[model samples]
Target: MVLLLDGDDWLYLHPAMSAFDSAVARGEMPPVTLVFLPARDREAEFACRSELWEAVRDELLPLVAESGVTADPGRLVVAGQSLGGLSALYAALEFPELVSRVACQSGAFWWTPDAPDRPDPLGGPVGGSLAARLRERHGLTGLRVAFDVGEHETRMLPHCALTETLAERAGATVRVSRSASHHDRAGWRHALLRDVAWALA
Candidate 1:
């Protein structure tokens, strides 16, 4: 299944899924099985929260499989934008066997555990908590990950660049690209579909 963790407004805006379907209709790509797992609380559900992951592993996946979606547990792809993007990568790192592929767009790599309370949150760290976790030497040989950031997002460049490099170093088949717009989904539309296709490839 393909999971989409995005802005509530875009919950109905299945640009990537729609594009995938169009591609399939045109014989460009094969049929895909997709599932949308919207985040209840963006910060709470998508962060590196151990409690949240445990609940996801213990309660969510099993329910999703039986939810009549025709999803394959072994062929999972998690896609998210912005903060959701961070969570997608976090899941790939923490639950490697479960998430075989990841599509992250404009991830908030500036996030730090203490930075939220600090005077300068964005300036406090690069790659934040996820970067620290990536340093743990988690082998991602079986994982395929795609990272795309907005070229106009100057503030997010360094952090995202570092993250892309680190994921590749961790042995994931990584694909990196830049979108034309800023952090908005308008800029992420193409990357979203392209990256997901790459991940599934």
Candidate 2:
């Protein structure tokens, strides 16, 4: 089974699965049990914190299992876009055993601990909080992570690029790609499919 992050943003992803389904029909990639974990509060859950992952590990997975879905805990891929993407990568960094594969699209790499009311929240950092974490040099020996950012996301490129490089440096098997459109779903669908395939491969 696979976990798709940011079910609160399901509207952004639901339509895109058709594209993935077409790829599945073409035998381009294997099908996954797409379990969407709706975030009751994205800002809280997807932050660089520990509570959310604990809940996912202790509660959410068991609930899915109880619902009669067969899932291999070892093979879970957590896919997320935007801040959720950031959180997915964060999970891999902090909880490597539970999250081994990640398909992250256009993560909010500009996030800083500074309040959002700051004149330029994006101005203070290149890779934000995650960069500092990445610098810690956690050994991600068996982790596979894919990072995709929109080609048109000029302001976002530096952060994503740094994170991509750092993840690789930390020993993860990493794939980085650029999507055609902006930060919208138009670009992410391609990322969601290609990156997940690369991660699994």
Candidate 3:
């Protein structure tokens, strides 16, 4: 089953609904079980901490388990765009064996107060170190990663780059697109469909 995670705003459908429906028409839309978490701003206060991720892992796995979509945790995949993309990568890092694939699109990799090379601008070591630490510490032996960002989305490049770096270092198979800029439903649908097709293929 697929999970269509919302972005930081948690209010929009991801890009590729039309493609998804078309896939459904062709019997290709993977069976999906959606779980919409709250907005990133709402969750950021606690996201750096382990509790939030732990809570999601605790809750979502059981639902999938009950549904029989993935009896083995290792077969599950997590995917999202923007903040949701960041969260998907973070979740897979946090729980390696449980998530086999992580599809990130225009991910908010720069959400931290400071970058890996910068000191904590937010006043704590943890603020700038989460992504780096995830890369350095996580075991992603079988993880498959995918990402897409628009060429015109200048503000998002650094974050997306950082995520790509980490995914590559973790031994993930990564993909990127520079044609699709950061956008609403209309903008992301094509990329999402492509990503989902690749992930499930």
Candidate 4:
């Protein structure tokens, strides 16, 4: 399992590893090798860019493979929140072999190629660029994705809902849910663990 966010926070602030271990102890899910990856440039790296995907596919994954971690290459799960969530789905759409399963929380689906330049980034078209891409793509038959967004994030719901519908329409086995809080990570913690397990299952 690859977790995208601050590594220290994921390890300390949240009991992600402990929760996973407990679930495994209960036979709720299989044991997984957790890989935490923090973003170097939040805006640039997390954007739907080919370069970032290339680097992960080429450099980072090779390093992980060389580390002798006991992980199934074919069953890799990528979990991310907000912008990272968008990037995780991007990886699944662009490189399905590398990222077939994903657990996304509160994805910034309002991101477009020129969204940053707009006065209100979130005020752009629904589902942003990813929606447009999904409308034209159709190779997600093997993908399994779980999408969770905060219930209080009213502005984000439309974008997320459209994207979820498009992904499922394009052949991905998708799961959708809503958390109790806003866009904050604290509210996403439980969903992260639960959704990851669902994706793995």
Top-TM-score candidate index: 4
Instruction: Give me the displacement of residue 138 in model 2, in angstroms.
Output: 3.7
Shift in Å, residue 92, candidate 1? 0.8
Score residue 88 of candidate 3 by CA lDDT: 74
Residue-level lDDT tens digits of model 4 in 35-81? 87767687898889878778877887778879886345468888888
Alpha-carbon deviation at 41 in model 4, angstroms: 1.5
* Model 4 spans > 4 angstroms off: 5-8, 70-73
Residue by residue across 106-144, what tens digits does model 1's lDDT show? 998888777668888779668887887777765778878
Q: What's the residue-level lDDT of 73 in candidate 4?
A: 46
Over 53-150, each residue of candidate 3 has an lDDT whose tens digit, in order, gives 67666886576567665535554556677667767777777667566777667776666633433564233332134457655754566777778877
Q: Per model, how many backbone clashes are there?
A: 0, 0, 5, 0
Off by over 4 Å in 2: 11-13
The local distance difference test score of model 4 is 0.86
RMSD of each: 2.1, 1.8, 4.6, 1.6
Q: Is candidate 1 or candidate 3 better by lDDT?
A: 1
Candidate 1 runs further than 4 Å off: 13-17
What lDDT score belongs to each candidate, Candidate 1 first? 0.77, 0.82, 0.61, 0.86
Q: Which digits, one per residue and each the tens of the lDDT, describe model 2 over residues 85-185?
A: 98998898888878888999999878776736688766768899898888897678788888999889998999899988888998988888888879887
Give the TM-score (vs. native) of candidate 3: 0.73
